[model samples]
Target chain A: MGRLKSRQAGKKFLAVTGLFAMGVMLLLPIFVALPALAGGAPAAGGPPPDVVAAQEAEGVEGEEVKVEIGRDVYYKTEGPAVGAPAPKTADTEEFYPRYNFESRVLLWVANQQHLYYGSFVLAVPIFCMCIEFAGLVSKDKAMAKKYDQLAYDFVKISLTAYSLTAILGGILIFTFLTLYPAFFGYLSSIFRPVMHIYALMFVAESGTLYIYYYGWDKMKDGLLKWLHCSMSVVLNVIGTVLMFLANSWIGFMMSPAGVDEQGRYLGNIWHVIHTALWNPLNVHRILGNMAFGGGVVAAYAAYRFLSAKNDEERAHFDWMGYIAMSLGVAFLIPLPFAGYWLMREVYAYRQQMGITLMGGLLAWLFIIQATMIGILFLTTNYYLWQALGRMTGGERFQRYIKYFVFILVVGLLVFITPHTIVMTPAELKAMGGQQHPVLGNYGVMSAKNGGINAIIMTTIASFIWYQRGNRVPAVKWAKFGNIFLITFFVVAHLNNIWVACYGYFIPANVRIGLSVPQVAGTLSCLFFGSALNLAMLSKSRELGPIRWGQIAPRSQYALIMLATAFTWMMGLMGYIRSSVRLFWHVNEIMRDNSPWAYTHTIGFGANVISFNVLFFWITILFVFWLGALGAKKAPVPATQPVPGAAPQPATGH
Target chain B: MQTALYLIISIVISVAYFQFIDWALMDMQGLDYFYILR
Candidate 1:
């Protein structure tokens, strides 16, 4: 009996030891990772033995070294001068070795995928805010309920994508550390404080997002709904700040300011964070993100619409698709102007860089970008046209589509026209010059501007046509209003064309300024013309109720195409922007000595971008599927309006 | 003189486009009215 008891005691002791070992194995990583998360510093104890031995081996002793434990500080130079080459010391010559393939390509894929998810998560909450507010103020109870349900759906879709964004971000950081460790180390050291702020903001954003999403049903009534919407506003603010902080890092890389030629950090952290290109990049990226988010949401709605089992489901998804598309297109309209501003800033910062981007090595990439833009605008117009089939009197406007199509096609042709062709030596000699006799004229910025502006105006006109579908203005000044709109558009077109023509006769310095007035003319038409139309349709007569689920299935495919085009264009532009800083780690400050520092061929770059686009789409589609699975299990609440049962007149006009 | 001519042409085109839209809307409304009356 004593022997049996001893055996049991031994077994018990063994079990306790195993449990202790397992617990330590699991909890050790949390303990190690916690210090890294807290300002990315080392633990309370001194440096690890291996790190100390490596530092000693590298002769990194007694040099006033700032021992950044978790973060790697690649540069050990003491206050390097601006515009001067960094000292080629053992400490500064940090090696970034790629295993098999090019490290930069891997970095590009990770960065683009991370950006795609980040933009999606950042953009959807703003849409949710606007939609929820609309629901709050809407007098139509049924419509309000529908809007609330839609807003809830948007947040639900974004939630899964948000987790994926964090995962992709972690992947991106790992890629940077593994692939371009030296560059990342230097960048992190300079923006350490901002990184801390960014981490804190991320935590706040996570808390707010969770609270806002979970508190939706609980705060569905009167004052609580308002409070819930206010939470979205808070969430978006944190998100926007986070985006700005991230942009500062990229902007500093593009246009390094506040540091001397040696790539030294100037005393002011704010100065380092707020580089010359910071605000412009911020504005451009924000607008682009909004448009991209809208496209993604619209594509999601389209997918749902296609899979909807009943007419009620179809109607709900249809209306949701329209709303998301409108939001997407609205931001898309102003996106080009923001892009123009960004380009102008790039030119102002460095004319040589701008030339390389627009007129030199990257020019062909711009041609491809133009094709993508043309596809985007064309697809948008096509979707709008297909949407008209849902309206009662929409057939009347169908005849006008051919004219719009003609203009859009011509514009696209001109916009994508290349200044030069890839020809054989003999063919080049035969052609006499790089410029095609006829098509070359259209390839210049002068003609391209005219083409794109025309496309924009035509798109605006299409929107107007869609707005007028199924409705007749009952206002007394309707005729006058129509005449005013016609005249305004004509003048806007004249001004745009005149500016384009005028650019050819002037010096480039003056010609660049002319885009300002050209953009202003388009804005006036969009703002004033839209305002006039709204007033005219304030109490419009409906021809018939719109059949929400009547649009063609092909239109949904167009939305997916739009999102894909957007993703591809973003990747291409990012490649161009980054490649412009050729052979330099931080523009002119630090030279890149890596073997793979040179820009890839256009074909290779295109393939990489396409691959990134494909990967992002595949992953995002999975995220959407996961979201749909959760949605499928949840029964539609009684408070939500039944779609298609009460067909309301289109109020978007 | 040339610029004025171009401007006039643009205005005329714009007006014509507007006129087409107005005509189409009227025609549709007329068809709807007849359908209801009949």
Candidate 2:
């Protein structure tokens, strides 16, 4: 025993020392680069005589003009304005070479892959923080330990993917430099300072993440655990900042600001970073990353559950899947609202761009997106309902499933209905127009909005049912609370449909405002109904200890399907957003004069998205295998109780 | 007044749809029977 104790002590000592060494090594690069970064600035040069002469001639007598002109010369900004004369071919040629092959497709794959890994690494740490906090607060030692173990497992999966993210990022840069050197150079010149900060933050995130993972065992007790969890916060902050910096680059491309009509950086890097679309894009991507991460993690849990040999292993993985799915669905519910805000911002930035996306060329893609979203919600509800099988009292809610299913199906049918159909001239004539007379009305935003809100509310209702699946509410007012909850949902649904219907009669300007109250109605049901359910269940009686490992195998497949759908949807949406710039490398500022400037057919786009999804799944499965091998070598601590044993609720309330 | 009537009627129909489901399938009065505390 003493020998084992000494050996363990030696291992812990080495682990701590190794972490310290890694931290120092990581900081060494930052320290060396700091001095260089501090001294690095564009070479001092006066504004060109012609620019100064022109400014004076035009009587542009302000500090802003002089400053802008000076910065323009330094940054080599030379793009045409929105309505200005088209830039000469020679000017555009200097930045982008005439590539023989399709460079855009190559860049697309690289970017999407990087984003997937980047989002996974960024989001898993957040899950880690939440789970670790849950562990810290729980009075039940066994349950707390289980939470910690689950968190540790989550970080482990992301650790391998982090290395892949960096590798993919390097490939992305190399692709840009080789294929689109001119365009990359111009962008780099504009975002020189941001690039430096991004690099430094990357190093910080890497160091913090490594320390957090390696020191997990050592910090499992008391004060060190809190410190360890705090490291996750620092990691996430750096990660978010890194993401924001990258987003600015994309946002600037989509909606160029802080520059002249002739693509010139106007001295204010802050303005360039905070372009009009920046915040909306940031919000959209953050929510997207969280949802995608949840899907991926849930898929990982499902894989483990399917392969487990023992009931204990199965039970653990089953619980993990539930937590991951719940987190993912929670983010999924509000994702459409974020998407709506983004589209609104897009319209605000440029009406033509918005019209092109929604009503013109890219409208078909939105229809495809509707189909994917419908599938996502349907799968989520199905998984939740399937989960009910593990609860003893869940049978009581079984009959209600059919009703929810009816609502979901109808909503999905409405949500996916396309406004126009692609057909031959004769077919179009037969229909009397591009739209089917009967289905045309269901295809517009009014009907779609109603459909989605109803879907969301139904999903929320499923969740409430799932929460109460194993418990019999013990509160004296449980019936009243249930009645109020049901009534609230009914009313909320009515309000949502009313808003949707009212939108049709209102003018377009007023119709857009209707979405606010519609979303509010859904949120009211989500928050208030959930709150009521929880209050009633606080002192509830258990039907039985939840049979965690008893869930049907089909539900595991649903988890995989959710992940696959999320991956494909993200790829498609990224393509749509990027393509909206249409023929322009930087919106109206810099035109893309490549052979592949035209948008590809929807069929081709779908094929490419599927290829990317397949590639990601294949690669991620390998990563999962690597994680599994590591787990086998150093298994999670067996602090959890045996399978089928009920975890005692934390007491002393 | 016409718009108001349309809106109100739409809401009523929507709410009534769910209410019909409950009346047909769920024994609403038996809800408290499932609650152990009550």
Candidate 3:
């Protein structure tokens, strides 16, 4: 034991030393530039030291030297405008290559494909990090081994997808340069420093990921395992910073900053990167990527489960699917809030852009988005219900599922209803207005907000039931706890609807504030309801062990549906965001005179998104096949079913 | 009697929680939550 303690101390020292080395590597470029920046200027608002020295050496007077200074657009500081204005490109072969196909379409397909693979690769590492950590912390020996294997499986799949991501990224950059050289040149020039850092960070991420994956077996013991897990943290940090740098370019295009009216870059790189929409976009995209990654992983597990040769394989894949779905749903729950914050920031940046997104030409796409969101939640609930069948005591909660169905349907209908419809003259005259007399009432944000929150609340309740499926509360305050939870959800649902109705009666300004309380009500149920349920179940008795592989085949289909829908939604939303810039290449900064500047019809956009989703699934299925092929030689996991002693996977919280 | 008491207490607590959240969030945005009552 003393030897073990001393060895542990030695590992701690090594770990600290390793961490210090990584920190220096991460900040090395910045540190290298510090001396140069310090030696640049001799005094405030004076000529640079190099310029003064050159003048003195040439026998020129100090007063003869005049340095031109420009003010930073966002930071409001004085500095040299080192970058040029955005190029004005004409509709010619020089500016846009005249292929038989549309350049915009080609670029769109490339960008979408790259983004899909990129989000997947980034998201899988995060899952590996979390699951690996869970393994390290778990007290159960067999469960720890299972978790470790699961995390390894996740990384193995990502290793294949990572190469595809890099290939697609290369294709996207080449497409940009070939089709839209002028625009690409300007964007790259303005983000020169940021681009260099992004490239370096990408390289760093690649090195770390390779080491993390390859060193897994050698580092699977003692403090080495802990060090291996920490490496994932470093991997994620580099990945996130890389994503942020990419987001800055798009954010600048949507709402340019740190540049003058003529599009001259200001000296402060931070001002350029930290545009108005940067923070919200970063938050939304991260959550979105995580949820998307979860869906893809779940679908992979489902595919494996459906084709398993034995009960052992089936049980292993079932548990894996559940864990992936839980991680995905965990991110999905807060995704809408992040999206809301993004939309709010868009409105804050430019109200016209927000109007374009929610109320104008792009409004139909939002309806599609709403439908997708509703489908995601519904599928999640359905999977949970099917999952409950594996538990002996789950039947007690089965009766409540139909009521949940009714509530969900009602919420979905209200959420998807359009405020206004495009109608011909005669049709409009027949209806007396653009909105329907009865259904139109449900179209407004107030009602839609209530509808979504209701759906979310029902999902939360479904999750709670799934958690308590095989357990009977044994706490002294079980009855009171049950009563409180029921009362809270009831009131919360009613309050959400009441707030929605109240909005119609009040002034518009005050009505807008109603959404805050409505969202709060849903979140309250999530936190308080779950807390109360867990407390009641703290000393619960299990009715029977969870039969992991006993779920219906239809549940796997639900997982596939969730993943496909997530992919389609990501594609549609990306198109909507890019289209909101309209004819401009960079909002008010740069204009695009391309032939395909106009927005495509909703049908066309939908078709393109569907194609992208289909293509992604086909390729990903191939990747999954490759993973399965390797599984023959892979070490067997400790997840084999042991009669009535199967381990319980963590619930989606 | 015990069930009734529990019901009453639950209603009071839930209502208070929602009301506080509403008022505080609204005030944070510089909006008056009690505009209707006023």
Candidate 4:
């Protein structure tokens, strides 16, 4: 039909636009960087060569003259001052305006809220891209349609949050300008060049996201859907670029570069943007966002499941929750490694900062974070086990659940154990040391690493069992495959524990290296164990139908618990990272002379984090309500029972 | 015998893979993985 041809041409047009947009987003950074590179920033503590030549010629032709130059604090490069040093602010109304309330606390609330919404919006688009791609590649038409609907539902939830993110961003900027004008002004001046680029990228992201969402129905088939899917890739690239640009500002504040000791610019913007902690931060945030985003989506699915009017709705929501949680756990597994890298970079940049975060004042927050991490994994494993109840042959693995719990509980106890406790002089004398003798041994990083890795390995094994719950591998090599998996996991756990035990006997410097191997052991199980399990299940026999909507309500609550833990941990970590800066606005480069520069008590910090978590949840619940308001029927029909594909509504076994 | 052989071979392969990961990752960070031996 002519309509079909027109649709085909429209698909080509959208595809070209998507590719063109991606090219621009990719090239924008290169174009921005090349000019600055070509500008030829000076050597350390000296003027540029051209400037030196000009000055010499002038002196030879006339009277002697001197050209002033500044050395970069981080890069050690030097150039004539391109901008003024950071302003010396007094506690006057001009520098720090206020209305009988604490400015820092207000800004803290604003920034945390903005970051929460921003992370959610950015993470959802990437999820959409993944789900949409999966749908496009799916050979089964019905499965493909369901995937498309799931992706659509995800983007719809984010669309409302996206608008709120922008509004919060504006509010944050206003808060900065009003509360701490001097500090904001100085940062703005330093990051002036890239600020507009960041703004443009935001606008581009908004346009792409809108088109990708609104064009879904029109481009439901063939090449048009591919174009729509590829547009999401462009959208995510822009979103990530925006996040990096924003991270650069924070990176500059933490470990300043391209500026002198006096905080004067030395003409190289790249050094300022790409500070020592930048890449580590970028990696950490990306993984954190993905995990956090998955948690939120899973929670939404759980909410829908609880209130579902019928079995079909319950089944669809249950499957949705599972997929979201799996995606979350996948990212959550690698998150600790990213955190370690960030911590390592912090140590590399400034040892005092690292000490303050882990061993000094903010150390208690880390204890809290470790507790949350334990809770998250425990809840994830519990949910997976409960998920097995929906299958007929699931009872075979049910007896092993207690052992997984035992291992997990042991790991959790070791992980949450503290190295030392605050004690009065008399109490310290009575105890003879800050550390409790036997318990303290378990509190060290070595034991903690072993504990967490064991927990992660156990979670992975649980997932593999869940995946193969009702199916028996029919391949000739199935027996060997099963043995290999079992051996691999058992040995991996032993290796991890051995490494942890070894760390206690080794030098601290060398002991630090042990974590790398321990992490590898855990990751090896995740990749190899899971891959081989999938291979074994490729031509498996089904034992029975996997009853989809038959799961207990408690499993949905577990998803909610996982999401809440993720949100709380995010707030806690953000507080720790920001507070570690101590009294400085930009580390040592700029001082924060405000009355509230001192760190709050741990109790107060916890209260503030709790408040942020509560506020975020209350608002997000509203967003979910709004999403539910427009709902009519379930997105996917009740899946018919099909053998070998438990993922469909009906059958796994 | 085949089952035991399968387990042993898997254990060997897993151990070798882990050892390489440990050495390479630590070496990348400029740390010696066999610091105790050295």
TM-score of each candidate structure, all chains considered together: 0.80, 0.82, 0.92, 0.92
Residue A66 lDDT in candidate 1: 50
Model 4: per-residue Cα lDDT over A1-653, one tens digit each:
99999977977887678667767867876886575567664322334469778889999999868546899888787776766899987788998999899898899889999999999998999888988998899888777777788899999999999998999999999999999999999998888877878998888888988888898888787666777787888889889989999999999988988888989877767778899899999999998998899999999999999999988788888888887887777888888999999999999999999989998888888999999999999999999899999987899998889999999999999999888666689988887787767766758999999999999999989888888888889988998888888888888988888888888988899889888888878878887787888888889899987787789999999999999999999999999989999999998899998888999998998898889999999999998887887665444345642222555211110
Q: Report the lDDT tens digits of candidate 1 across residue range A251-335.
A: 8878886566666664445556667788989998998998899999988889999999987788778888888888888888888
- Which candidate, 1 or 4, has the higher DockQ? 4
List CA RMSD, all candidates.
14.6, 10.0, 3.5, 4.1
Docking quality of model 4: it rates as medium
Q: Runs in model 3 with CA error above 4 Å?
A: A1-13, A19-79, A423-440, A635-653
Runs of candidate 1 exceeding 4 Å displacement? A1-94, A420-440, A637-653, B1-38
Candidate 4 has what TM-score?
A: 0.92
Candidate 2 segments exceeding 4 Å error: A1-100, A421-439, A636-639, A642-653, B1-38
Compute the lDDT for candidate 3: 0.87
Which window of ten consecutive residues has the lowest lDDT sum in model 1 chain A?
A68-77
Q: What is candidate 3's TM-score against the reference?
A: 0.92
lDDT of 3 by residue, A1-653 (tens): 99999988987788777767777766886887676568673222223469657868766553554435676555567766556877888998888775798888899999999999999999999999999998899887777878898999999999999999999999999999998999999998888778888888889888999999999997887767877888999899888888999999999999988877778875667678889999999999999999999999999999999999888888888888998998898899988988988998898888999988998889989999999999999999999999999999999988888899999999999999887666799998998887778866768988899999999999989988888889999999888888899999999998888888888877878888888888888988888777778888889999988898889999999999999999999999999999999999999889999999999999988898899999999999999999988988766664543334433333344
Docking class of 3: high
Q: Which residue pairs collide in model 3, if any?
A: none
**Which pairs clash in model 1?**
A81-A261, A81-A262, A82-A260, A82-A261, A82-A262, A83-A261, A84-A261
Off by over 4 Å in 4: A1-67, A429-440, A633-653, B16-32
